[model samples]
Target: MAERSTADLALTLTRASRTPLPVQVADGIRALIMSGALAPGDALPSTRFLAQRLSVSRGTIVAAFDQLISEGALLASQGRPTTVHPSLPAHLLQQVSAAAPDPTAASTRRPASPGASTAAAPGRPDPVPAPAPASAPAVDLRPGLPRTTRIGDAAWRSAWRRAAAAPEAETGGLTGLPDLRAGIAEHLRLMRGLPTDPAALLVTAGSRDGLELILHALAATRGTLSIGVETPGYPGLRRVPQVLGHRIVPLGVDGNGLRVDALPTGAAAPDAVIVTPSHQYPLGGSLSLDRRLALLEWARNEDALIIEDDFNSELRYTGAPLPPLSAIDPHGRTVLLGTFSRLLSPDLAVGFVRPTGAALLAELRDVREVLGVRVSATTQHAVAHLLADGTVRRHTRTERLRLGRRREALLAAMLDVPGVRVLPMHGGSDAVIRFDTAGSHRGRAGADPEARAVAACADAGITVGRLSAAWGAESQAAPVDPSPAAAVGGVGGAGIVLGLARPADGAFSAMLPRLASALATVHHTR
Candidate 1:
């Protein structure tokens, strides 16, 4: 095969597509390979050269190349140009001409730039367009997402380099890398005041992955267990158990977190229950100490396990951090599910599980190994380096301060809005606003005020989460059995969850007044 210039690649990209630039590039190359535009052993352009030609960052090109290499569609050897797999079948070569981009595409389509639509540049090929950027939200208040730009670029690059240098054969055994586990243990001891044995921690893809592992380990002995999750709780957590063919029991929450008194007893009692203790999702309330002890006792008495999701506990801006259920449990009935998705970037896809016992932990490890459920080796190492070098701690500190400021801005914006009750957020990046219709003045026909409120916010280019949507599907699908002692104590209502960690400091200032007006409109319409 002859070496072709970058311009001769004939790649067409649309900026308006939902697909990311890197994915688009990768898919384009893959299609070419499958259709045999690039033959067996044909070398591809260097990352730097391709990046320049595509007008994208080198990192984007690197990511695409890495994905292809992983799939065996391309071969990457040290100190040599990347080439197509030598074993590619001969029949695919026939489709090359049909798969190639139309040569007249440039002439037919208008250019994006003004005044360039009709100005013909003779024989000049159309420039490859980057993916269209989404319109910016005036204020982004969706919870569980962090502002990853706060992380230092230098530190991030250094961590990746350290990860790349890791031994390819070091699969981290069953749990994960030894250094990573040790780093996680030390982090728990110092930051969370929970001393953990390194061997007790099992690295997972995320908190959900950790939950799945535990369920897999328990399913053989427990046999299709019933699980209890909070009402108006995390939809993600609620879906997992049901997806695994287990029944869901809806437990409700008040201002002080989950109602432990409502937990079922006897044969109907759940085998396991998941709780977000330090900071409850959507509601932004902590579990009271007395209730915490009571809940732990229930777990012990019922012979049930508690899956404590200590999400956003480290971002506390007021008072002291409450001890997690795992930290206080004496009976080892609590398994802690912690993730970097809220604290760091969700892109990392890194989390860990602190199982109830060494035996159970071993079982979980065995299950993970059998199922081949391990986080990326590179990601594990990178996160380990960040944790070991105190980079994560430093980043958390910076992010906390940033989130605190945004919280204040959010409060300031909602001060004048009537009939909307704002809950106090001691920790976490989100706050709940309950909509009341007592003295609403501006009326709308045949529309729910809460729905109108959310729609208005969206129309104003301000994104906010709906609290009512988080209710488990089981609660909605099943009829209300009021006779049961374990029936949910609370009912779903209209409320909004505003995430404080999303907006940049500069963008926040301009968004506040607009948000206030939107809230006011909702109040008036109600």
Candidate 2:
């Protein structure tokens, strides 16, 4: 039995409007709650009482209450009166009350034209939305994370339900469940134009997992091999190798991506090289066809391997994505590492590796199982369901449109900001912005412009990835003049990686001015 409030609320319902009666009722209640007419702990009328007053079915009232409860607008409990959610922050309540119209004066107030509302009244000042909370972090633009808001509620629920229904160990194996591997293979073939056999695919947790597994397999065969990693690239890639006790050879990436010619020849050459050919990490540049062929040629000649990180290749907005390096490697020297992090979310941790052969696949599985490194069986099943049901494909389309819009917004906002160079993005989840502060401040404290910009962004609560930090320890150890103007990797100086897709809806546009202001700080003060 639930208690009911005696207070009566004024609500207007129109049968002529396209909006449903239940929705109208919910909106009316929400307005009252937001406008301070209904305070926290104030009881909501019982469904029966409200239904009788509004002349609607009890079911309709229930539906309205349920909607409000789902949105945290109202709180409901067993054997207790339904009331406004008390846990809501005071600032939010204040914001709503400030924005909402006066309920007592509603009947006396005359409707104003849309244009009229845009301007402040002659005697009364226009109501402005409350400022965002001071504690909230500014829009995070660090690369790698993706936006998952576009995933439809129905599709998400269906995937999770299917996952929940399936028994954990029933369908999973060491290299991931057979169904999931097959699903990944099919997805690759259809979306990436990479014809992969399920037998050759080994599902790992993510790109790092796949890389570690490959390193294990490589170590078993080659024994303590030296690996070439892209300099001023993903530090995790370098760190993962170091953890495995493999010697890291720092390789540089230019406008085209990892420089193949920079690799040592003969005895000094690394046994294998890891490259992000399909939109390089941190810096969003795709490997050129000539370089791809050259890389494959190098691998074939040295009898070495090329671990291709096909990260965010599927999210290319402009033209068709270039064929993956693995696709071009006819000698079976290329191994592809991919993940669902950008497609879906990082929490899935669902990634796969297309090994060079069955031998490598078997070795990877053995290493993974022996080391007890396995993704949750439930997550694998959910991802597999998404792939098989074409939910991922539909979601990818929506994500691409969203990413494109955000990228455009970021570029447009930074266009006028001094000393901030927006690099061209071929196709990837992130964009790079180089900072050039020449004559601002040249002292020891303000030597590196990239460092200054990163600190400024941090102070402003904007989380952005620094390009200089991406360099391997070995790369950073290289001799330099210690001058800020010393250009590295063809760029004038260092930059920051912006994950455009990470911002919430309507957040990117709102934070653009703040971002510009932050960049200006570094641009002007050295």
**Span of ten consecutive residues with least summed lDDT in model 1:** 115-124
lDDT of each: 0.70, 0.70
Clashing pairs in 2: 141-499
Q: Write the per-residue lDDT of candidate 2 for residues 218-239, one digit (tens) a residue.
A: 7776677678877656666667
* Leading candidate by TM-score: 1
TM agreement with the true structure for every prediction: 0.71, 0.70
After aligning candidate 2 to the native by TM-score, how far in Å is the CA of 236 from where it should be? 1.5
C-alpha RMSD of candidate 2: 23.7
Tens digits of lDDT, candidate 1, 180-248: 898888677545646577888999888889889887776656666677787767777777877777767
